[model samples]
Target: MLKPVELDLSELGELAQVIPGPEPKLELSLSPIPQFGAERPRIIPVCEPSLTGNELKYVTDCIESNWISSAGHYIQAFERAFAAACQVRYGISCCSGTIALHLALAVLGLQPGDEVIIPTFTMIATAYAVTYTGARPVLVDSERETWNMDLDQVEARITPRTRAIIPVHTYGHPVDMDRLNALAERHGLWVIEDAAEAHGALYKGRPTGSLGDAAAFSFYANKIITTGEGGMLVTDNEELARLAWTLRDHAFSSERHFWHKFIGYSYRMTNLQAAVGLAQVEQMANFVAARRANAAYYTELLKDIPGLVTPPQAEWATSVYWMYGILVQDEFGLTRDELRRRLAQRGIETRTFFIPMHLQPIYYEMFKGERYPVAEDFCRRGLYLPSASSLTRQEIERVVDTLRDVRR
Candidate 1:
């Protein structure tokens, strides 16, 4: 049975008041989805991709053309379109977002024992990618306000071994790229943006991916513009792209087929994936609009609900609201996990924030004494609600009402 909702318009006015002043930036983009509200006005996944586009058409064309492999026109088209959209000069498609990061480090020739700064609150893939290059991921705590890397903590961590900084734009919100970039420029370090969760988000009126030296994106099925399972690395440096192109295809030199100039893993994105990705990119603007609207509605409905801290926006950035996350304050009478269980019983699916990299089993021994209070606290209290691009306004109300019911 569908529950009727009383829409709240009053709290919405608060939005305008918080609208960021110009420090710099612009836009949010479109994406894919999986509806979990099946059978019983059912479960709503934490994030879903909106697939209302020419996805089928373009994919069918690739199938008909028999170019489902890596070699095809769609590859170039997707690369060009995504690169242009991000205001970068080149987009080198890869097998996954993790590989995209690996490619960035690989091209920079990150040798063993080199250090790459990263936020502890990010997805494991960020750190894993650093490991892929035999480099150390120097983890830092997130800032409490935006749940992004604490830039102040970064400078102190840099040593002679530090080579790059990979800032995962946490939860679709842009990090303080200007400050990070300034720090990097001072230290002669590279900035690699792990923009997997932020496709069309902006910082200071500019796209996030372009703010760093090399940006990595994921086309996972749940991303804004998905290719089911793919990733891309965009940059303005011609030599870097050249190196990546060769690296993506097993390090083969252009002059010779099957001859290896260097040892490289095959990280190429298939033509079929590119075909779907092109269609998804074509619909990005609309997708971003839907996501923003959905997030706004969520904010409106949950405004008066005390003890819940909704996602915060920074004045210097435009968030994509990748997943409508909230932090359950201690006063809330329920633990974050407890609330999630309650929502699960109501057929609402939610996801907890990342376990800080320092706490992960694989990295525990490596970071035994290191502690990041902000990141650890978020891990304990943060969880995102249903934030699929395909979510409806009514669905947002249901999620809010259900949450209210849970608290009651």
Candidate 2:
């Protein structure tokens, strides 16, 4: 469930006293579509962090306490808090989302040559993490509408060696976790949700991270919430949680310090990062609301533009609009690359969708002769506009106008 931010103005008399009152506004030429002989306004960045909360305060506390390493009150507090936020029993904070996936895979005990199914449209980290565990990643195409993995390929990709499926929640819109989990259960396979993009997003009233057997989340600066650079693995199974905890560190036995058993990597988030993460987690509800509002405004302004398919919101999903992507049809005149260039020339930053993994040169021999047409098409046409949570109503209008004016 998305908890919308509710301000109580009556109780903030002290805050209200310090806030400057509204003043007369000046009219400047700021339309995305410039008037004849007028100059367009300056650039708009694609994303920015909204860190107006206790980030500094909590981090300062860690420094003052002299416990700024991975071990501190803040670390455990953040794990518990984030676990609760995801509606899971445990959240093992790690170094990055990639490492989180690595830990989850390691905990699953996937040996060399074991295949893990993943969507080719996701960030390379998803596939790389599987490779880190000595497991082979089987690529699947994305759905045309949602740009998520086409579930129909799951069965085709799975075999006796197929051990797990990693369904990444792309653009803050969750994959059908319930259905994915049902499929996993049928094959006795594990489901590791790559929920790096779906923080605060819900599917059928359940949080994305909680729906999968174990989920990995990224706290990269551009994510819905940030901890500078951190990641977490949340799970309902205590054994999985325990194993991930050890795997994140040096795989030392918890029974004795400096006692090593299995191979492990150093993937620990410091107390300082956790301090920042805790603060961000507290503001999650409000941050998601702001992103959703910004996306809604963009939709409202762009709906009338021909040949532009807006970010999808499925009947069973509540998207947080993490990147606010849109598909540019050929009828729009400019190709996606050309549009991106034009948008950049107009001082509006944009990002194209990830190149399909199947098309990447690194996998040429492994996936040769295989074709995933839908993923190819979406990768060419899909691009994300400026989706900063701090985007203003006027900014959204300007972006839409600039897009509307694109031509051959």
For residues 1-408, what per-residue lDDT tens digits would candidate 2 score against the true structure?
966544443433333222222221222234445442456575777888888999999999999999989989899999999999999999999989998999999999998989999998888899989988889999888887677899988878889999999998889998977777888999999999999988999998888789888999999999988898999999999999998998888998978999888888799999999999999999999988988999888888888777889988888888989899998888788777778776776778888777777655566557766777777777778889989778888778777777776563
> Ten-residue segment with the worst summed lDDT in candidate 1?
23-32
| lDDT value for model 1 | 0.85
User: What's the lDDT of the predicted structure labeled candidate 2?
Assistant: 0.84
Candidate 1 — which residues are off by over 4 angstroms?
Answer: 1-39
C-alpha RMSD (angstroms) for model 2? 12.9
lDDT of each: 0.85, 0.84
Per-residue lDDT of model 1, residues 166-215, tens digit only? 99898889999999999999999999999999999999989978999999
> What's the TM-score of every candidate structure?
0.90, 0.90
lDDT of 1 at 286: 80
